[model samples]
Structures are given as C-alpha cells and as structure tokens.
Target: MKHLTETEIADWVTGLHTPAILRHVEDCPECRERARTLASALQLFRESAREWADNRTPPVRMIPARRPKPWAVRWAVPAVALALLVSVPVYDSYRRDRQARAETALAARQAAEEAEDAALLSQVDTGVSRAVPAPLEPLVSLVSWNSGSWNASAGQ
Candidate 1:
C-alpha cells in the first residue's frame, strides 16, 4: 500500500480521516512519524497565529469633518428686518416734527407781519392827524392891537 501524504495526515489529525490513508499510516512507521510531526507543526502555527492576533491593534475609524450651521446669517436677516421696522416709525415721527416746526414758523411770521401793520396804522392815525393844523382864521391884527394899547395908556 502507498503511504499517506502530509495533507491526508493533517486532515486525519483534525478529525477528517480517510480510511485508505489511515490504513497506510497504521502499517508504515515513516508515514506515522510524518503525521505526528505535521500535527505538532499545525498546533504551533495556530498558537502563534492566535498570539499575533491578540497583540495586533485594530485600525482607527476616521470621523467625517462637519461644517457648522450659519446662525449669523439667520440672525442677520431678522436683525435687519427689526432695524427697518423700528426706523420706519422713528422716521415718520421725525417727519411729523419737521412739518410741525415749519407750520409754527409760518404762523409766527404771519403774526409778526400783522403786528407791524397794526403799529404802522397807529402811527399814521395818531402822529400824522395830530401834526396837521385844522383850517381857521386869526382873530386880531398886530397894528390894531398896538393902537388900542396906546389909547388905553393915554386915557389912564
């Protein structure tokens, strides 16, 4: 009978026995020794492989980079809108104030003009009327008044 191969011997040691190769290894001393040596080598290789697996570090998982949310842009829109809303009322108030000031100035100017007209009328009526003489004739002459005075003095 032919002796078992190393593959057959290894398989037999691991509980995968073939009957014909088993019969060969049972009768052949050289085949039996080869099977024993292969079994020992397989055991040593498995132990070292386990040790190497235990000592090895796992690969690190890299996290993907993330971008932050644009809160500034979100807030900026609301802030601008609020500013416009607040300014609208303030601008309206300022416009109203300006209009009121203009009306007040116009009223003051009209009042001043009316007062000046009243003062001119008063000056014309009082000063000009009082300065002009009314139409009248003189009662006595200088020569007649002097002759009467001389006669009275002579009689006295």
Candidate 2:
C-alpha cells in the first residue's frame, strides 16, 4: 500500500483530509514528520501575526478644515503689498548696495581668476589672447559721445 504524502498529512492536520488519506497517515512515519513541520510553520505564522497586531497603530481621524476670515484677507493682502512697497525701495536700495558689493567682490574674484589664467597661459607658451571682451566699454563710450555732442550744441 502506498503511504500518504506530506500534503495529505497537512490536509489531515487542518481537518480537511479524506478518510482514506487519514488512514494511510496513521500508519506512516514520513506523514507524521510532515504533519509536525506544518504545525510548527502554522505556529510561527500565528506568532508573527500577533506581533504585527500588537505593534500596528490605528489611523487618526477627525481633522477640522480651517476657513479664512474675509476681514483678515481684505486687510492682509493690501497690508502685505503696502509693506512690500514701502520696504521694497529700501530693500531694493539695500539689494542694489549688496549687488554692488557682490559685483565688486565678483570683479575681485574674476581678476584673481584672470591673473591665474594669464599665468597658466604664459606657462603654456601659446601666444593666443584668451581674455574675454569687456561689454560695458562701448555703452560708456556711446553715452560720453552723446553727452559731448549735447554739450557742444548747448554752447552754440
């Protein structure tokens, strides 16, 4: 007679085995070992599920949705804009001063970089000029020429 397999034994453990399969396992050592393995696995699964349940947090409910007050909105926008307008000129002046300082700092940095570049270029023995063109020179010259012409016309 063929002995019951592990699957048949697990079905027996779960009370789902056929009567013929149960009878076969009752006489088999291999089937008994399989049944014991299934029982241990089931116990481990139960312990893990219990631990998960113990550690899990229930979700939060009940958040009140906030609505803005009309008066607050009416005052807040213009007040903020007016504050911005008054402070912006001062801020812009401060920013312009900061920008001037930053430009001066950047110019110093660029001068140092150019000096290094020039030193490196000198070391390479390539007589090519790699210096970038100054963009502000033409505009300054144009303004000076217009002012001179206006002054000459004014004297006439």
Per lDDT, the best of the predicted structures is 1
lDDT per residue (tens digit) for residues 55-104 in model 2 = 76863333453556658867998999999899989998999999999999
Give the poorly placed runs of model 2, Cα more than 4 Å off: 59-156
**What's model 2's TM-score?**
0.33
In the predicted model 1, the residue pairs found to clash are: none
lDDT of each: 0.74, 0.73
Question: What local lDDT score does residue 93 receive in model 1, on the 0 to 100 scale?
Answer: 100
lDDT string, candidate 1, 26-71, tens digits: 8889988998888899889877876776677873334554443569
